[model samples]
Target: MAQESKPVAQVDVRNIGGIDEASVTLPEGVSILTGRNATNRTSFLQALMAGLGSRQSSLKGDAEKGEVTLVLDDETYTRTLQRRGDSVSFDGDPYLDDPELADLFAFLLENNEARQAVARGDDLREIIMRPIDIDSIEAEIRECKREREELESEIEKLDSLERDLSDLETDRREKVESLEAAREELESVNDELDELDTGIEESQTRKQELENAFQRVRDARSKLDNIEFDLETERSTLSELKAEREELHETIENAEKPDENADRLAGRIDELRGRKRSLDDDINELGSVINFNEDLIDGSGIEIYEGTPSDDPTDALNADGQTVCWTCGSEVGTDQIEATLDRLRELRSDKLDERSEIRAKIQELTDQQSSIREAEREIERAQERLTAVETEIESTESRIADLEDQIESKQEEIEELEQDAESIDVEGYDESIKLHREANEIELRIERFKDEIEEIDDEIDKREAAIERREELKSEREELASRLTELRTRVDRIEETAVEEFNEHMETVLEILEYENLDRIWIERRETEVREGRRKVTRTRFELHIVRSSSDGTAYEDTVDHLSESEREVTGLVFALAGYLVHDVYETVPFVLLDSLEAIDSDRIARVVDYFRTHADYLVTALLPEDANALPEEYAYTESID
Candidate 1:
């Protein structure tokens, strides 16, 4: 809520200070009272202060009776000061009677005094930050800070919980990986067992086939033996042939194989080398183009281009007129030159990389070619041995064929005898039986690993739920922090704006009054401690300082004590006016009653009066005729007091 302006309509005074009786008509703005010493100017202003609820006014000269009557915008109120015995009694309107107004009046009276208390090194904060209810604001701020501290502590605890949750998550991840590996291994084992079962079945079938072939060989042997001496002679030759055939088989198995791609690798090397040469040429061309552009930009080849050198190379090129190309000496546009330079730089970088890569590939192919040549030589020796072995095997097989023909003719005679014989005992069936047993064991182990993985999965889900609860706590703490920030910001803004508004008006008034040696005035909020009985209480308040510049180009700050007597009076008045403005005193009492401002010079007094005319609706100042004449012509209301 804003304070509305209530200008005083009139005032009647009797037996107040030096005033015996006086009735004054106050205009809307800037009313001057001209009087000599002891003409009751001070008394009249005092009465005005008292009528506005100042407690400082008293009955004059022990006359025992004084009263001030004030006519405000809506009502007439009178305050009478009466002395009975040793005490004084004040009677006035109860609604208008406010102790706060008395404090404001006291500040103004102190401000206008010739020996200003602020100028005498009193605490300036106590004067300027008045009517702010600092005690109440400080209490609320303290409570807010306490609550904020508690929230911060809780947040720290939650952060610890979050760290624990993170550790649990890490453990869960490791367990999950372990479980996944176990499951994968179980699946691998299962597949291996399945393959083993198939291998066993195939082995059993092959065992039966070997038994059949062995039985035929035995029958043939029996038939050959039947042909006595002839079979014996033929068998000796067959033995020799079979021994040679065995040697050939061993030789063929040990022979080395040749690399079929030896020729292909050599051709790739050649192709890469040719590409590398081409890339080198491209790179060289790009380098020349880049260097030519650099020379043009650097002004090293301007004479070759038939253009004069300028401080800035880009400025030397003209887009409209005929311009010679720096490298080709052909007429070209400026845009074309810039585009060519940019393209050449890009091409140079690309070609350089391509050339390096091609060279590396060429080196790799050369190494491969050397390895292939060594392999080819080894293969040539192995092929010669293999060919000799094949020739020996063919000769041995020819002798064996002759012997086999005779044996087959005899075996036909013996086949009828062997058809009645039982099948010979089969061998190599033990390995298949052993593999079947192992597969059964592996299948059992796979089932156990799967069960363990399921148990680990359950533990991971529980840890994830705990992490969700931690997140909820973190979100609650964040809300508390936001609210705390808002509270602190509001408190600071209120205090800052109050001091800032006061300083702004104070500096403006000081400038208008032409206060010398003072450039700026402001209030600084500070924290201080005072002793209350045996306890120390900390308080926050404002302090005043004035900035002044010396003749030697140095700036310094000092309190109001550094000001002269008249300067201090002006400072005090300006400060008082600033407080009045900050607190919106004009709404309650729209009059600034000032008197005995003779210490201030006439020019400054005129300016101060002019300022009051705009800020206050009723400006009543007590001045001598000389000081009154200094006021502007617009302030025409003046009353002479006798």
Candidate 2:
């Protein structure tokens, strides 16, 4: 079971000068009394630590009494120590009803002193000398750090090697790729050169073939021109012969037209005969009508009076036998009439005679008609020769077409031959081939570099193995260094413990006249060294452990380096308690007047109360409203407000 609920204490506050009357009650575990500043609160606490039951209680050990006290553990008693002017009643029995003793608390106070003299345990005494041991630890730390530095240097060298190899490998790979690309380019250019050679040959041969064909065609055209001239002369002579033949044929056909001329002559004779009969009829009729009124004349030159045919000449003759014309009114003379009649008969006779002569000429020509057979045969021969020459021209055109086909075939073959001859480069090609060879050399160099890189990689692997070995060596060195440092620190602490023990024994003798916990103290050698790959350890390496005690013979054996805040302050109170306990032994004054009694805090005060409460000697303590409330259950009734 844990500790049960303990009793609590209450307190009241008021202005010592100008502060408020603040108040509170406190429960037992380690109650804290907190507030703002300028409360004059600590003054109230200072008055409480002044627990001098007798006049000798105020004496210092070196002065009169050795220890001091407060109300605790029910009562107080005279301590063992006697000062120059104080009195004592027992053998270091300062606390009368002392039962509440805490060793951890007394150690806290002693080790933190200017020198740890009051402690009776060696370990308890060693804390005061902790600072001096650090020098030994520093030496070992330096050695370990040196080893770490050496390892770091080795790592840097390996890193440099790794980088150099990596860069070389990269450069080698790039050179290899360059060589491969050059090889490909060379092959492509060679193919293009071959095609260009073929093209050059084909064009040259075709141009030559075209020149020869053009010459052959020119010669053939000259021969065809002469043949065309001969043909044209023959065609002209044929045209002349044809024209004469056609004219002779037309003359023969025309001479066969005698009936045409006879028709013309008969038509004219009929017309003349009809004219004479008309004249005779007119003269006879007129003779019948003119009885003796006119004399009739029957001569070739004489004509009867007949006016223009448009007029009635009969009406013109008067009743006397003759009359004048009605239109011109000419005289109607018998001779004039006879002359017109005679002229008409003579014109008719002439027309008949001319027609008779035309018929006779047509008859003579018809008897002389014949065909021009010689001219016809000559024209036929000329036309046949023209046809023969035209046939030869057609045959020559066919032969020219065959020659053109033969030339085209020969030209294609010669072009291919010319292109093949040109494809083999005689000048620049050697340079291109040399460049390709150099590219291959570069590729070989790259391969060699790659092989070297592989060897370097193997070398790097071996170096890494060495680096691992170095790291292992460093690790061992570091472990040894750390141990050496710890041992040296121990050795220093042992020496310091011896010194602290001597001082603490003196302090205990002064305060209690006894140091019973001294047997727990001893010093040990601490430092060790590495020899022949082994640690030569020391058997005794550090200080001994010790404990402290109160006047009631209670022990305090601990280290105060780790004490809490309240515990630390209470440790100070214990120191004060030792002074009070030795009150009667070194008597001079009755009171232990103090200031700032709250410095120890109420929890520790309560602890002190339980140890000195019965205090066959009386104790008086003060109560500030705040601090008084902080008194714990173990010392609840120990407080007495002043």
Candidate 3:
């Protein structure tokens, strides 16, 4: 039986970087690019990077345009680079739409940021965390907090409404009981009045007169009862309005006043916005300069008027080295340009951080301004409500006084009528008079009871209606709580994961390499206070620590600078691999490119390759012929590109 052929990725390049034309097929697992120096090994890697949607690759000097085509798993992606004056523009759909993750992690070229960060002792935390949008997360957290606060307030209102239910039910029951008793008393009084009757002779005239007087008394008493009910209602209303007025007064007193310099904050925000715009322009210009210089260093489009470039152009760059400044057309050192570029990069990073801080500051100020405006509106509304309540209280008090006066007048009128009826001086008239007076009292009591019962029913209906909203408010509050939890932990979770991944991979790689004196290497996540704007905020930092063993077997901490070139290279590669895994880059881009590993010996290099091979579908690395010999016989090898 014949063995099945392994899967392969074929790459075609034309005039990209130093490559005039090249075709290479990479197999699954490790594929080695074996050659001596200046054999276009790095150039082919650049071409591959171009086909993977990286803009870092440059067109060849003599070629006006360059193209790279990649075929993997029967899927073909192409990238075209066109020379546009001092800059090169790339067009075409490539393997990855966004190459930021690939550039930072999967492409481990010598100049890759993640690899260089460890070598240069750059902020490991910043590089590992570059992909996360912390500001957006924090903003979302703030929004969740606000929503939760609103939900809490609504839930409180629902709870208060629910608590009042029992009291309202009790009041309604009491009013109903009083009504039943009054109706019974009224029936008794009516029966008693029916039993008393005057004789026939004096009954006709005197009975009619007495009946008129008694009817007038009854009418006065009924009016008085209604007037007294109005008085009670008005008094209750006045009491409620006075209580509301006091509350409004307290609200106005407790309301926050806006900042005295609130208007100045708007102006400051505008100023920061202008500053950020200026920084943007500077960063763009600096980036263009850096790209152009880097191309020149790569010997692309620089042979027209200059002396012959060095075979290894970057090897000649030193602090004292001199070269012609392309922009100013003056004699300047190559190292000076590189140093300037480095400074420019640092400046750009600082400005970018400053811009982020300014953005967050602007959001903070805007929120504060909105809150201040809301407070002002609240105070204004409270004042208006207080005024309305005071006016209502005065009107209700005046109405209550008028009702009291009417009650007194009606009472006097009833007394006069009673007196008139009592003086009739006829047989059986007094008994009839007393019965009529008693009947009037009972009737008034019954009317009052009816009015009370009606009010209680209305109140109970309102309380029950309000309590119906309780469940909905509770549900909303629960959702807000869940959202807040997710938002608050998002940043912390990412930070912890990154730290753990780095420490774990670093320990494993150090053991695999078996560095004689190296004890351990790890990263610790720590927090420190940083002053942003006028406030101090806590921020997380990643601290890289190196442990080394002395001859006596005593372990001590070491700095990155003390690590050998081979050790540094291994550490950097491990760090990049950690990032690759942390970002899940393998799921999208299956290829990992490695170069510039001449510092590590062949045996350890093989071991390192073996370690990284397990994590990628295809691991493509460039090596010298001697170093490539150390790899296993089964690994695919491309000695020359055609």
For model 3, which pairs clash? 322-333
Which residues of candidate 2, in runs, are more than 4 Å off?
1-145, 156-459, 466-474, 480-484, 487-642
lDDT winner: 3
lDDT of 2: 0.38
Q: Count clashing residue pairs in model 3.
A: 1
Give one digit per residue, the lDDT tens place, for model 2 in 1-642. 123343443333232111133333334433332332222223222212112221111121122323323333344433332433222322333332221121111111212221222222222222333223343455555555666567567656766665676665666567557656655665675565455444443455544453344334333333333344445545565556556555545554444232234345445545655664454344322321221122122110112245442223244445555444322546666556556545643443344344333433432332222112223344455556545545554555555555555555555654554344345444444443344334434444444445555665666577666656765665665676666676655655445544444334434332332223322322233444322212342333234333555568677665545333433343344443332332221122222222234445555454444443332122334434465565553432323211
Return whichever of 1 and 3 wins on lDDT.
3
| TM-score-best of 2 and 3 | 3
Where does candidate 1 have its weakest 10-residue lDDT segment? Answer: 106-115
Candidate 3 lDDT trough over 10 residues, lowest sum = 297-306
- Number of clashing residue pairs, candidate 2: 59
Residue 97 lDDT in model 1? 60
Candidate 3 regions with alpha-carbon error over 4 angstroms: 1-15, 20-31, 47-53, 62-85, 89-98, 196-479, 587-591, 633-642
